[model samples]
Target: MNYISAEQLTKSYGVKFLFKDISFNINEGDKIALVAKNGSGKSTLLKIILGREIADGGEVIVNKDIQVVLFDQEISFDGEDSIEEFMMKLDSAPINALRNYHQSLYSTDTKFIEEALAEMEIYKAWDLENEMKQILSQLKINDLSVKMGMLSGGQIKRVALAKLLTETRAEHRHTLLIMDEPTNHLDVEMVEWLENYLSKEKITLLLVTHDRYFLDSVCDIIWELEDQKLYVHNGSYATYLENKMIREENLSATIDKANNLYRKELEWMRRQPKARTTKSKSRIEAFYETEKVAKTNTSKESLELNFEMKRLGKKILELRDISKKYGNTIILDDFSYQFQRGEKVGIIGKNGVGKSTLLNIIQGLENYDKGEIETGETIRFGYFSQKGLQYKEDERVIDFIREISDNFPLANGKTISASQFLRLFLFDDQTQYSLISKLSGGEKRRLHLMYVLYQNPNFLIFDEPTNDLDLPTLTILENFLAQFQGTVAIVSHDRYFMDRIVSHVLAFEGNGKVKDFTGNFSEYRQYKSQQEKAGISETEKIAEEKPQTQKSKKRLSYKEQRELEQIDKRLPEKEAQRQIVMEQLNNETDYEKITLLSEKLEALTSEIEMMEIRWLELQAVLED
Candidate 1:
């Protein structure tokens, strides 16, 4: 049975066309992933289907007597309220009854949590509130006593999602789940868990997510929204890729024929007078339609990476006797390693197990409680972080990019203007001057990434860089990083990306247990599964076991420790110099001199982190 069907859907914003006569239907057991680039009307179409927004033409017919649960992209709470209190407010029950229902869930006061599930066997009202807690816990939001307002962006998104899943899973009636970017704020572990849950559940789901792994694992069907049209692929993600490749081959031939017809029509139009007759007018409209199809750039062009960088020296980075603590919680302890050249390391861990903290410590953005770090003299770094590049709302794309370097040097030794460089990253001529705040989330991420490359750092550190970015951009970035010459470190939850880009893994187990693995995430999972099935703890084999040293080994000399302390002072100085050079590049007209100085300044900025680390690997080896 069909749950919903949208027929001849047409919508537009003034002169901008969003969709034209697009149609699709949802079946009773379909798990669909809606894929599209940023600002391509994915969210708009979802709103139209939910009846929150009206399409200019056509109608959506949802099956009668079916419950619809939605998890919107943007959801907010009005005022301060505890999580428990918030739940009670959402329900239309009496205070005492709602209180009992809330308390029975995951509370020691009663075994009523299970009893509520038994009560829900008859589909009672109270079970909705209590039964949903199972989902909330699985989503990793367990603290009910916490205030809703205190939740982080990711936490709030999880709360909204938990509510939606619980609502849909509560009753046995037909239901539809419409989710927008459902995996946007999820970690890898949580994303995997949700994927498993959705794959087994009977509810019909339509969700928009950029995580390719989630799409592949959970969805049985894929709906690609492109060029104001919908293309349905009735299989898995791999099948969708295979089918789309065939469709594109056919489309290219059609486009070539249309282009030829459009050119002939254009030449004929220049010779003929303005057509007033109905037949001639209809013919002119046909020419215009063909021209539009030929000129569409959507999904036709992919972004390119043009990286021209300085040579990497023998020295890279070293971490020795490094330890970090937040109050009483230990993060990293006496970690020691020497980063070699051309190594791609992917860091994996739970939400707060200090993967990002380790990156920050290496980048000299954060301080450690103990230990020293080392760096090479010629090292330059490009850090692409989720908290990257804070741009003012009024800032233009070109203007922001000019701050890093007014010119980008190509491998052929030719230089491109800042605006031209931005275009290569998919920013168009008109969009170069558009306000930063007006861009989509993925666009903003792309813009930030452009600035990261603008510095021309030889080394790169990315901390959760794929969070809000679309899949195409991620694909291009993966290709770029795979070919990059310098050492790289990634802190990402996108497991597919990790497998593709990195050769090694740094798996961070909780409680300051860090281990090095030899292969990609998939291999690590296989090894972990084998260990689990054999009744062996993963720690016994994989923990970062300190090498046994002789008792005669000497500790760090007083001079070395003092030099490590001086790194705390020198790092700030180098950072200040990089900022000054960046400002000068914005105003300077001398492109040649500016580019050289910008590279030197960036190298200096990275040296601050490297300076302190280089001390640990110096002539004195502090063996423990």
Candidate 2:
């Protein structure tokens, strides 16, 4: 069964032709992945199919009965409702019934509760509610009562995803799931969980993502959009790559053959006079067709990075007894490590586990509570963070880059102009002069990366650098980092990129525990799997053995004892703060102020819980 069919699709933006006369079909059970460069109209095609956008000269026919669920990169919400209220607004009967059931649990009216219960049973909303809760929990959305306005950008994306997935299941219709950059802003563990979930579910899917491991596992067909054309490969990502190479090679060879024939025809035409016979006219027409193929461009635009850094001294970065925390939440505790001159380390952990915080502390953007950090004189840090580059929206892309440096120095001492540097990063002449606000999200990320590389620093620190980047850019960046001469510390969720770039891994376990492994991410994963199979839980093992060695091998230091005392003093203050915020929320009538007070109350509650847990641990140590 065909879910959607598009014919002769032609679209353009200003003077640029995105695609011309393209045709495709999304059949039932087709798990497709659309791959393309940053600005290659992948999202636009999806919009056209979903009837959200109109094409210049084409029609998309979608089955009226099939349900389409789009997980777009930019979700639209007014940011005024709680998560439960937001979900209840969806047009799913089960969702509405479940919301009523939950509300009745808090109601004092017995008649309302009985009616709600009957509706839940009729709609089978109990199972839907359980599944929604599970989805929210796995995505790390613990506070459903919190307003949507209080969430971060990443958290908002996660919430949108959970809502979409739950809604699709509840509707009980034939689902055609379409996602754009679904893995963005997710940690590695979350990505893995999503991969597993999608692979197990029997839903038709079409998504645009740069996660190669995910594509290889979940998608069976590859849809490549390039050069105003669509090429379909009926296999996995690995097979698509191999087949694409073969196809390009064959096209080049055919073009070369056409050029030879066109040259012979040109000689014949130059020697003869104007043609009068029908046979001569046909030969002239054939000559023009041959010439067209001969002139086909086979050269592809590629991203190139070959910049050398300043010489590194013998002394590199070193941290001693580093400890950081917010109230009682420990980010780092006595974390000590000496980074070598040319080391590349990958940081891996769940979200909010202090990976980005560690990078900020190393760069001195954030302060540590207790630590001594030292760096060599030759070290110049180039930090690319998740906070992203702050740029004037109206400024031209070229002007933004030029503000950094008009010329970028290469490894061989040759310099390239700002325009040339932008071109190397796949920004064309027209795009260079365009406003930054007009660029795509991936394009902005690529531009920021170009700015970071232009500085020519000896030490590089990147936080979530692969979040919005396309696959081609990621491939070249990985190659460049593999040969980079300076030290690199990267916090990325891209497993393929991490496996290719890093030599070691730093696993940021929660509660200030950091485990350093002398191997790449793949190797570390294998080691972890082995440990799990052998029934070894690191946290459980540590808990079991800590009491025996608490007084002898490990004792609370002066700073730790002071930290315990501070937590004791702050717990009561945090509880009082929570009480005040709750009262303020009750008295507040303005929606905005209520949202703020609710956020404050949630923060205080979390802080108090952590402080109480830390206080108990400290007491246990003292008793030991």
- Can you write out model 1's per-residue Cα lDDT over 1-624, one digit (the tens) per residue? 988899999999877677899999998989999887666788789888888899999989988878677888688674487766665554323333455555676577556776554544444655565566777887788888899889988788888888677656544679889987787677777888888999898879998877788888888889888778899988787898888789888888888888899899999777877646788788888989999878755344444445577778888998988999898888997776668898999999887779989999998989999899988888888899877459887888788888778998876778888987776666777678888888877788888887887788888999888877776667767877876778999988888888888877788877776766555777566655655676767454333222212211235456555454444333433454555557667888888988887887677667755775675564246544
lDDT (C-alpha) at residue 69 in model 2: 88
Structural similarity to truth (TM-score) of each candidate: 0.78, 0.83
User: Which TM-score value belongs to model 2?
Assistant: 0.83
Best by TM-score: 2
Model 1 ranges with Cα > 4 A deviation: 78-80, 92-131, 171-173, 258-299, 303-306, 535-624
> Which ten-residue region of model 1 has the weakest summed lDDT?
544-553
| Candidate 2, residue 195: lDDT | 94
In terms of lDDT, model 2 sits at: 0.84
The TM-score measured for candidate 1 stands at 0.78
